[model samples]
Target: MLGTVEERVQSCPECGEEIRTDHRFVPWCAACDWNVDPGEPEEPGGRLEALRRRLAREHGERLLAEVTTDEALRPRRDAASVLALALASAVHGFTVALFVGGVLLVVLGWGGALPVLGALCLPIAWLLRPRFSRLPEDEQVLYRSDAPELFALIDEIGGAVGTTGVHAVAVNGETNASVSTYGLRRRRLLTIGLGLWEMLTAGQRIALLGHELGHYAGGDTRHGLVIGNALGSLRTWLYLLSRIESPTAPEAVLNAFYLLPRGAVLGAAMALDHLTLRATQRGEYLADSFAARCGSTEAAVGLMDALMVSGSADVTLLRESNALRGHRGAAGEAESGLWDRLAAHTESIPASEYERQRRRGALRGHSVDSTHPPTHLRRSRLLAVAALPAAVTVDAARGSAVRTELSGARKLVARRILNGG
Candidate 1:
């Protein structure tokens, strides 16, 4: 400073351009026009938050307009088109037949042996077909007989959401809940996270259950699985193809030729996936709307707030669980200790920090690959809907029993995680 030192140059994290500035502070990149200053902390609820709020408000307005004008959230025809196209592309029968024809032509000496070589390549590619499987054995499953109170609540929520009974319920060691279809008949399986369940109130729990069951009520379970599986298959195939190698020059040329058509197919499949994703986004809003209607709007909103807070709460709980690995407590005592640690950690989080977390959540946006809409958008959509009374409620006694049952499951999951299972 005594000699008026020159400013240092640094690489911009965003654009990878060299940032040169004479100023001692507030450095910025000219290439991408992004701030390159590493010293400055980001402002709380900055421009991104403002932009997200505006967008959410506008989206909410449009949704309300559509509800008033169209009478319902109309199904997207583009999604159906995408599903059809994906199904058609997945059928490789014609390509197989062409490979067979090429083999025949080469066998009869109608052309060079290249056709037979290409036909042989088809079998290699077929052998490399991506295999898909579902694994639920690792998760802790709970039967209705095991947790009757929890089952009763699920039944109540299912009834309110106009769905048949869930096939089974499982405890997932996370801060979220999901409903998925399994097996040939597509039986609905519900997975509830103990971390989340522990933090929610009875009303919030009803909203949570209704929200997941609402996916089934909206036909999302079946259609979403189909589109998701198709897209996953397309992505996996592309990844496998990209991993394929050619050691020789001729093989490299052949591989190049093969990839040309394959790339085009993958591109088209990606476009369809994009369209399907849009429909899925709409489905998420619809599910939120359903949840708000089935439970009180306040409860639904509270559940979302809980989701934002649960992330931090879950991390804190997991850290505490890790510290209890070598403890020689009895089974029930160990479980109680885990819950006690979780509660203390959760309560220790200050109100201001929780508010900050909520603000951060509001600014968070979903990527194209994400299945759900952003938290802020979901909140806005629910706020736009008319308020409704809660469809179901659990008495304190029943709620306590349900929580006790969940605690047992939570202890099992915690033990497994801490034991590095």
Candidate 2:
């Protein structure tokens, strides 16, 4: 009896075909017609199908709530931010003083000290800076109370698109989303805000997610991370030092004394930042195309419209909220002024709609919960993508029960992953 039981466990349940335990970690029981780790609890009406439906519903709600609520998606590292600032500040102060003093010394007959001081600061800057720290894991950075379904979606799309599974999905209350890679192994992170979830249509959401995944799959995120970190350090150092030194110094004197080496750093940093930002924007366009090929166009359009509406709505909400709270910031006021000036220059939207959008856009400063290009711009880009002929199309006639089952199962897992399971 013991020998028979062991044999049964190893055999395929359906055809009695030997259940090949492939070393690649794929546990497919051909006889039983099942995967080894069929993720999620099975439900009736075909367990995987039912799970997919549940996930879709949950994903919709999460999108809505994430945008409307005030929740911290990632842990705030005051210490890290402070350390970064201090690193820049310290380097700037020392460099400025050295350059100025060196020039003054050269004029005062003490030139040899300049080279010694310059040599010393270079090593100190390298030593004092932080080492590569892995960003907090996906689970730690995000909170997903209703994550099962989003995980399901990610699995479905990522599998079809040949991208790594999403490592994290998070929402801050803003009309934006971003994907990033950090550290040695370059783990991928998928970040969405409450604003984005609530604002985009389901199809649009998928498209956006696809775009983020494209970055992960294409290795753009990792490149961006390295460039961003390197440029950020140099930018900070240069900006701080430039501010500390007086501008009245002659251009030749300034470059020779304070600017020559630092200017090179500044230029390089600017180029990196610009390139990184441009790459992200371009990734959005490709993802738009990717999602269109894989899924429903209606869903894609819905996502874009949702984003636009929500963004317009949030601006109005913010202005009112700020007034109610009786808080006014200089930068916020300046931003509002800029918007007002732009609004004046543009063709007028309807009064009611205009007021509504203004209120939503007014919610705090750009730094608060804002990132990404404005909704109108993104919407225009999506529409352009939609106009393109799709590279691949799903064949309804060829779709099999097995394929449906696979899609359903994948969806469930992706949703769970996204929701932070």
- Scored by lDDT, the top model is 1
Q: What lDDT does each candidate get? A: 0.63, 0.44
The positional error of residue 215 in candidate 2, measured at the CA in angstroms, is 2.2
Q: Determine which window of 10 residues in candidate 1 has minimal summed lDDT.
A: 35-44
Q: Against the true structure, what is each candidate's TM-score? A: 0.70, 0.46
Clashes of 1: 0
Q: Name the TM-score of candidate 1.
A: 0.70
What lDDT tens digits, residue by residue, belong to model 1 across residues 227-341? 5555555555555556346458887876777777677656655455444544556667667666776678899987877776776666656565565667746434655566555
Q: Please give, for residues 1-421, the per-residue lDDT of candidate 2 as tens digits.
A: 0011111235655566675342312345533444533443324343222433443333433332332242222112234334443444544555456556555554555556765665565554554343454554432254223454456567677765577666655444445666765557656666665435433434455666765666565445314443345544565556544634444557546656665667666554444433344333344445554555445545555555454445343553354344434333433443333323223322222333333332333321121211133343344444543243323333443233323333433333323322323
- lDDT for 26 (candidate 1): 46
State the weakest 10-residue window (summed lDDT) of model 2: 1-10
lDDT of 2 at 57: 39
